[model samples]
Target chain A: MRAIFLREFFGYFRTPVAWVFLSVFLIASVGVPWFLGNFFESNDASLRIFFRFIPWIYLFLIPAVGMRLWSEEKKSGTLELLLTYPVSLGQAVLAKFLAGWLFIGLALLLTAGMPLTVAYLGDPDWGTVASGYLGAFLVAGAFLGICSACSSLTANSVISFVLGLMCCLLLVLLGWNVFGDLLLSLNFPVPLVDFLASFGVLPRFNPMVDGIVAFADLVYFVSISIFALCFNRVVLHR
Target chain B: MSAPHSTARIEANGLSKSFGEIQAVRNVSFSVNPGEVVGFIGPNGAGKSTTLRMLTGFLRPSEGSASIAGIDVLKHPIQARLRFGYLPETGPLYGEMTVVEFLRFVAGARRIRSVELDGDLIRVRKVCHLEKVWHQTIETLSKGYRQRVGLAQAIIHDPDCLILDEPTDGLDPNQKQEVRDLVNEMAAEKAILLSTHILEELEAVCSRVILLHQGEILLDESLEAMRKRHPLFGSVKIRVAPADADRSLSVFGKLEPFVERIDRQGDHFLLRSRDKRNVSDAVLAVSKDAGLALLEVAPVIPRLEEVFQELTRPQSKFIEEQG
Candidate 1:
């Protein structure tokens, strides 16, 4: 597992994907607040505006990171070589997931300029900033897990990316009002809609952005990640 | 370092695999003793790769079992895997990593202790001639260099048994020779099972050859025994003028009762028979009848190529069924 983690983590930098992902993510995370969110004009000392665009950016970026995790290995036939080693399938999957998640975490860390800039200009709400970062990490992990699951379902990276995008889109839509309105209009059970909305990422993520660290929200994101990883294992076994 | 073991280093019993409706391998059973090189030879779709994959634990066998160094592969995969090195047909590699980094990663993955990694890696690099490309990324290296890197990774742990599938598949003659030489050098210490369709590859390195045809074992014997047991053995070769070739062929064709096969080569004809009966008299009589002069005639020794062809021929199935 250690070996796989090292190889996969360093592998991202071997190509342009890691660099490109970091730049795009950093620029979007910081630039969105400065140019559109009125970071300077509002005189608000919190990173709440910056946190709003994370889910939308991650919906595409996390897939890009996770899409090749298994698909490239399968296509290049390296997965056979990998599995034939002493490592178990579960170990391999965990190592790959952690590496991708850590990579996204590293990208998140690079955007430290955002909070630092907020701190430089005024007294920033450090608690909210920490919560926001934590929430973004959880969201990235969940999205990465889903993308990795999609990657295991096929040998084509493009198909894996598109599949991952669709899956993440569904999870994102689950929390949005449009989906609930559509379901309500269609005369679905109100209890069912309420239960699913609670499961969506937005419900858990919104509170974290507001410095509200609920145990239930933490459980929600962590469970979604664990479920995706379990699904990945099942797909590979088949 | 090259001491031999008394027990079989690699063993498979009644192994079989099926992908949905297709039964790719059927009851394949074989064993390799230490210091012995076994060649798994077969035609395309003959279950060579499937059998190797099953033995390596990359693909689970639907029935039966395999063991390496006395450890059951399925029951204890990591233990079994630790004892053997396998190179699939493609020699799958990490294109982004430098040769040294890749080798280091394999060593680490195989769980080699940090203390021994440096020494083992140095020895493997020397053995594989990878010193030149140590720092070069795998994708930039030539195919031969990449194959060597693949080989280096396989042997980094110094396994007791090695299973290679078409190790020389796409290599040039020089690279193939290099791989063959490496196999021969390593055979003194490790039990080796090589899967290849190339006949000469077996002849070059294998002491024993397992011939598979259509998911069944057709022949399992030592090279010397195979050569001697071939029906083409003790055959006679005769050469006559081009004009007499037609008449000589006709004459030899008439002796179909005595000849197994009559192979023609320019003005030369090779007459094979299952029995040691001297057919020279019949050939002389035919030459006289046809008013042809025999240029030369001599006893011919069958080659490994002929033995392989005879064992793998479609008609051999009928013969085996009848027998």
Candidate 2:
């Protein structure tokens, strides 16, 4: 398991994919908040604009990082050699997932300069900023887990990327006002409608972004990540 | 049943696999003893790769079982994998990695840590002739060198059994010879199961040959036994003048005691006999008695290509007939 983790961790930087992902993510992560939102109306009291765009940014960036995790191995015929190693399928999948998650974590850390710049410019809400970082990290882990499962379903990287994007888009759309309206018009049971809405990414992640670490939200994200990783292992074993 | 000190490296019994409607392998059973080089020869799409995949635990069999050193491969694949080194048909390699880096990764995967890595790398490089290309990226190396790197990684762990599928698929004549020599050297301590389309390779290195056809073992015998059991053995060709051909040919049929069969084509008489020595002597004596000039007399040994064609042709006919 350690061997697999080390190999996958180094494999990310050995190719140009890691550099490309980091550069594009950093550009959008910082550039959009400062220029498009005008530094949150020049107030700098909170990272509201940055936190608002994170789910959107992650929709594309996480797939870029995780799509090739298993697909490339399958296409190159290395999956067979990997299976022949003395490692369980679950161990291999978990190792690869952790490696990709760590890579995105590193890319996210590069944007620490944005928070530092805000701190230098004005009295920003440090508590909110810390929680927002935590929220983004947890969301990135969730996105990676979902993308890892998609990656294992196909040998084509493009197909896996598209499937991953669609899966994430579905999760993001579930909690939107439009979806809630649609469910209400159908006259669905209130309890069922509320239960479904609670599963959405926004509802579960909103508290964390607002500087509140709820136990239920933490359990929800961790459980989804573990479920996705277990599904990835099952697909690979098949 | 487990033996603490048994010597068999691989054992399979009634192993079979099917991908949906297509049955790739069926009712196949074979075992490789220690230090034995068993050559697997078959036509294309004859389940050679599928069988190897099952033995290496890459694919689960639909029936029967495959065991490596007494550990059931399907029940406990990791243990089976630890006991064998496998080289897939495509020669899986990380093109972005240098030869040394790839070897290091494989060693790591096999759980060889920093302590024994240097010695393992030295032995693998020496055996695979990879020292020259150690620093070269895999993508930059030629096909033969890439194959060498693949082989180097396989043996880095010094597994007791090696399963190689078409190990010499794309190599020049010199490279092929070098690989053949390498396999021969490795076979001294490792039980090697090598599959190839080239018949000469089997003849040169393998002590025993397994001829597969239509997912079945058509023939499994030592090289010498294969030659002896071959139906075309003891066949000879003789060219004689037409003047004495009639008389010489007339006596050929009477020499059936030493001949298994005979075919006459104008002035050339093809003779297949059970007793090669007696047939040659009788032909000499008859030609001398009739004063017939014997132009050519030589034994006709059937090539492996012919044997393969004969084995596969019957199966094709069967399929066509069933259709």
* Clashes found in each candidate (C-alpha, N, C closer than 3 A): 0, 1
Off by over 4 Å in 1: B1-4, B238-299, B317-322
Listed per prediction, chain B TM-scores read: 0.81, 0.87
Spell out the clash pairs found in candidate 1: none
lDDT scores for all predictions?
0.87, 0.83
Question: After best superposition, candidate 2 residue B41: deviation in angstroms?
Answer: 2.2
Output the number of the DockQ-best candidate: 2
Query: After TM-score superposition, what is the CA distance of residue A201 in candidate 2 from its true location, in Å?
Result: 1.1
Residues A1-238, model 1: lDDT tens digits: 8999999999999999988999998888888878988877887888888887788889889999999999999999998889888998899999999999999999999999889888998998789999999999999999999999999999999999999999998888888777988999999899989888876788789889999999988888888899999999988873
Docking class of 1: medium
Model 1 residue B32 CA deviation (Å) reads 1.3
**Candidate 1 colliding pairs, count:** 0
User: Model 1, residue A237: what's the lDDT?
Assistant: 70
Q: Model 2, residue A7: what's the lDDT?
A: 78
